[model samples]
Target chain A: MIVFVSCIILFLIGLYAIVTKRNLIKIAIGFAFIEYAVNLLFALIGFKRGALAPIITQIDKPHNFVDPIPQALVLTAIVIALGTTALMLTVILRIYNRYKTFDIAEIRKLKG
Target chain B: MLFIPLLFALPLITAFVIPILGKIYKPLVWIVTTVVSFILFIIALYGVAVTQEIPMSVYKMGNWPPPLGIVMAFDSFSAFMVLMISIIVFTTSLFSLRYLSRFTGQWKFYTLFMLMTAGMMGISITGDLFNMFVFLEIAAISSYALVAFGIEGEELEASFKYMVMGEIGGLTFLLAIALIYAKTSTLNLADISNSMQVIRGTTFFWMIIGMMLFAFSIKAGLVPFHTWAPDAYPAAPAPISSL
Candidate 1:
């Protein structure tokens, strides 16, 4: 409910940053912010009212366990985020090397 | 049954193996990749034939059933996607042999290209939601590197922008999947769909669907997200750009 709405709000804020910002790195970070917000929202989605972690150490019957599927899925998504972040940073570094600036406006040699 | 896994595994294994052989013999990069994709294309044709008979086939990994284990399901649609991918990869590899001569590190190109192919195949055939996300990342990460293969200023800029959009897309998709899983308590697409029958037409359900649609649109470079597509394509090598 409220948490989901807040998550959407956070995503909108990131989208706003992307739309309004001019720095290349800032825009990249804005993208990362959106991802972070979404990941948070995902984890929140799997939250239970009064549930324990969805793990089984012994053979006892579990009570009110949180869903494990989204947790596993989020772990995989985080790994993906890490890879994309590293790659984005690498590309940004190369862009800086060639253009000598991080400003999106200044790096517009591809302007049509 | 076996062919489904082979469709993903063969290309992935070759992606890793090609880079090593490439260090020793350069020409083998083109030969190996081209032949592998051609074989995959043939396999995809066989997949079509097999599916035509059975109509729908499911291959569960580790012999675990759909609700617990990952499965690869092939029907007309997935088989068609596989066939399309095989054709695209085979032609791209063959063309890259002549077209990529001007580019250094041709072996790296073939390696990443095959990796992307493997990822695409994995995405198309997998019946599990999370498995699709993982494969989508594999394809995306490889493409990000491929787009920046030239390492020019514009190329790097474009690749960075593309990576940003793609990561956001992936995360949004994960959010949607999480929402679905929270409601359905299942990760299998078929299982989720079955359970969804009991809990349809809710606001939560529609939000999940909307989020998924938005994510996929970004991935596919639809109108709102098409900003990265134009810049990234031109930045990549000509052969890869065509791909």
Candidate 2:
């Protein structure tokens, strides 16, 4: 329960960064932070108290294995996060190129 | 059985194969994408037929049962979603043929477009929670790239904003999946739904629902989460905006 609470705290911190930060890069980093926090939360969920890694070298017997589904899902999520982060960075680069500034306050062309 | 997965597989194969063919004949790209979408539409119609007769169809990969292996289940809802997607994809592919001439690397645009289509279809049909996440990400990453397709300043900024919101939603979804798995020890939707009957009134359950609601609200562009939608919709090309 404490672990899950702490994970939500990490998520809130990232949300704070996104809401408060002025720099586009910092906001992008905030997004990355959220991804990491959630991924960490997921990895922790599948942990068994004293279980071994969920790998079976021999089929004779397997017992007390940690759940592997969350691990696999987290891996896929990480790869997808990588793609989004790379694309976000590239977009930030272009924003810097045209606006000549990283501050979100100054990029006022699309204000609603 | 074969057509259940083929709805997504056909377009996925075409997405990769068309790029190679595009280098050989520039005009072949649009033709192939349009035709693939049309074929998928036909397949979706057939799926509608199958679903009408049986009500639900489940296809297990590698012949593994529902709890142990990845499953793709088609019901009326999934068939409906697929049908809608194929119709949009077919028309957009045809429309983009004329609209995309102003942009360079038209082939790349079509490639990403087809990938997004496949991803959306996969998401709608998948019965496993993790598979849905993977497909959601595939669709999302492509949309981010497509929004910034022009490489212009406004477009890039919008795409960045959209990407941040989207990533947050995706991560939250992952967290919810984790919580659910911890509780139920299963990732299959049908299994989870069946197991969910016994578990009730837990904080984790509420958290799962809350997180999923937040995540999908962002994805669906609900009122509060509408911040990124306006900017992104206008910035992307017409076909992708509609998609």
Candidate 3:
């Protein structure tokens, strides 16, 4: 339960960073943090106390094993996070190149 | 039956093929995208007709049965969405053929467009929650890149802002999926629906529903989350904005 609460806290912290931080890179880092926190929570969800890895060697043996679905999901989520992170960083680089600064306050071309 | 998978597969295959075909001939990219989208539109029409006869059709990927493997559920609603997507994609591709002549990297635009089409189609037909998320990400990522395709100052800034908010919504969705899995121990939509009956009106169920609602509202650009739509729509090209 503490771990789950910590995960929510981490997610909130990342949300705070994204909402309050002015730097483009810091915002990207916050997105990464949120991704990691979600991935961690997913992986932790399938964990079982004293359960072995989900590997079936015998047909009739009744063995305690952790749920493997969340593990597979985490792997896919990690790959997606990688793609989003790379794309975000590339966009940030382009933004910095055009604006000559990392501060979001300085880049205000699209305003209300 | 087969038309359901081809709705997405044809575009996905052509998306990768266009980049290579572009290396050989530039105009081939436009030709191929137009042809593929037209064919997809035809297939969607066929799908709608078929679903009209058979209201619900299920295609189990790799012959895996329900609750075990990913399934594509093609109902009348999915057919309607697929038809709508095909119409929009075909029209947009036709419009962009001339509209994108001024752009230097035309092939990249078509590739991303096809990917987005496939993603949206997959989302419509998929019966698994995780598969929907994957397709959603595929479409969302492609849109992010497409929004920034011009590489201009305003476009890049708008794409960045849109991406941050979108990712936050996506993460919240993943958190909800995790909780749902922990409670139901299943990711298949039908299975989850069956199991969710017992837990209906519970706090946990409401939490999951609320999280999903929040995520989808961001995707749909509801009132509170409409800020990204205004910026992103204006930043993208006319054809993409239409899509």
Best by DockQ: 3
Candidate 1 off by > 4 Å: A60-64
State the lDDT of candidate 3 residue by residue for B1-243, as single tens digits. Answer: 777778788999999999999899999898899889999999988998898789999998888988999999999999999999999998899889778888898999999999999999999999999989999999999999999989899999889988988988888888899999999999999999999999999998999999999999998889888789989998998899987
On the 0 to 100 scale, the lDDT of residue B170 in model 2 is 84
Residue lDDT tens for model 2, B9-28: 88889889988998899998
How well is each residue in A40-106 modelled by candidate 2, as lDDT tens digits?
Answer: 8888888889999998877887588887888887888888888888888888888898999999898
What value does the interface RMSD of model 1 take?
1.9
Q: Which numbered prediction scores highest in lDDT against the true structure?
A: 3
Q: Rank the models by DockQ, top first.
A: 3, 2, 1
Q: How much does candidate 1 score in TM-score?
A: 0.92
Name the regions of candidate 3 deviating beyond 4 angstroms: none
lDDT per residue for candidate 1 within B1-243, as digits (tens), equals 789999999999999999899999999889999899999999999999998799999999999977999999999999999999899888888887777888899889988998999999999999998898889889989999999998777788788778778877887887777777778877898999899888788887788889998999999999988888988888998777766
Residue B117 CA error for candidate 2 (Å)?
0.2
Candidate 1 chain A has its poorest 10 consecutive residues by lDDT at A103-112
On lDDT, the stronger of 1 and 3 is: 3
Indicate the residue-level lDDT of B47 in model 3: 90
